[model samples]
Target: MNEYKIEDLLFEELILMDQEASDYEDLITQIGELAFEKGYVDKEFSKAVIEREKLYPTGLPTNKVKVAIPHAMVRDNVKKSAIIISKLKKPVLFKEMGSSTDSFIPVDIVFLLAVNGSKDQLTILQKLVGMFSDDDAMVKLNDMKTASDTIGVLKEILSQ
Candidate 1:
């Protein structure tokens, strides 16, 4: 079995769609509130992620899909750790990581992330990035209608 299970990292309460946000902070606030309500992290998580993202944007534009894996080192503020997967109702502009000119692009799929430790975060992130790099996986992930479906796909991929 995989040491890190996607099912364990993902939860029904953390999956959401049909949210509308005009900017980065707006979306992070909405995501952070849900995670806070579920007792995964504190209210400061949103601010932390927003601040971190400004310095290190996580927007990844793939051949199949566009995504942003937003996260923070919120060890001081985190109560627990969980990952939130969401699809925005509309694409929001985010600065690309390592961009010299500060270019920005629209990102629709976002992975709002939290992890208890650096080791755990690295393990989970590696699994997620490898999976998301697959064209088929990204297509299916974008097509998922429910959280269960998303979990199922990740479970299947990560279990390999």
Candidate 2:
């Protein structure tokens, strides 16, 4: 796995807290565009992420909050191994991970990953999954008031 510091992958400009979107696609596209402008991903990154989400849903129904991890594996499009943390203003419908298409959940947060390496993707995903499974952590994340504050807490949790 590629060794990376959590802080390095996180950008203040990429963090979206209390954002409103019509749906998952809109949400992903909005964030993707921001990342692309910042040189973190290519132009096709958002479309690819939407297509990937359609085939393999990434939503997780945790104890306190429901979250989604949306990403694509187009290595060339990923300029850097970065993460966009978006806390939606209202919940959006998302098909649950590993579940049937009809099995949908309302996702309050979206973790949009743009990782260039497969190993790095899996490593960051594992850390995120562990964090999501923790009820206290989920609640804290859901209640976080500021993006920078949330980033600090995430760095502390995911750095391990």
Candidate 3:
């Protein structure tokens, strides 16, 4: 079996900018297609994530910047663990996480997750959230000049 480190969950092919999604659903679908193409997940992953977001949104209002960490049921069809990091040219509205009220937030960044199991999901999530919460990280993400720059920052974030 292949050893799955945090690094394993990240690929240069999976990172990109200018997602150009008008809404949350479109954003999720676009990332899902990429995830499928990269052999990280199946087709059902995107649909599941879209539906899941309706019930339990992952729109996190962080200190640095707002981001959505959307995911779906992965126990069955996940071929590999990977995160598809996408940047929105224009922010899209999404429901807030764990809110009793029907609160919505504008998410500038989206982290579409496809992990093999619960452990990997939680581990990467914790790390990703930690890095996303930093003002410096957010700044770097916004000012990234190239795909490799974003990939480099993601690698460093995962290392920490």
Model 3 TM: 0.91
lDDT tens digits, residue span 1-160, model 3? 1357777776888886877887899888888888888888888889989988988899998776789999885456578877888877888888999998989989888888887778778887888888877888787776776778888877776677
**Candidate 1 residue-wise lDDT at 141:** 79
The residue-by-residue lDDT of candidate 2 on 1-160, one tens digit each, is 5487556788778889899998888989998999999999999999999999999999888878999999995767898779998998899888899996578889998999999888878878888899899888788878888988888878877765
**Predicted structure 1: lDDT:** 0.81
Among the numbered candidates, top lDDT falls to 2
Which is superior by lDDT, 1 or 2? 2
Model 2 CA deviation exceeding 4 Å by range:
none
Candidate 1 ranges beyond 4 A from true positions: 1-4
Query: Candidate 3 has which clashing residue pairs, if any?
Result: none
What's the TM-score of every candidate structure?
0.91, 0.95, 0.91
Candidate 2 whole-model C-alpha lDDT, 0 to 1: 0.87
Tens-place lDDT digits, model 1, residues 42-160: 88889999999988998876668778888996666677777898887888888886788778768878887787777778787787788778989888877888878877876787778
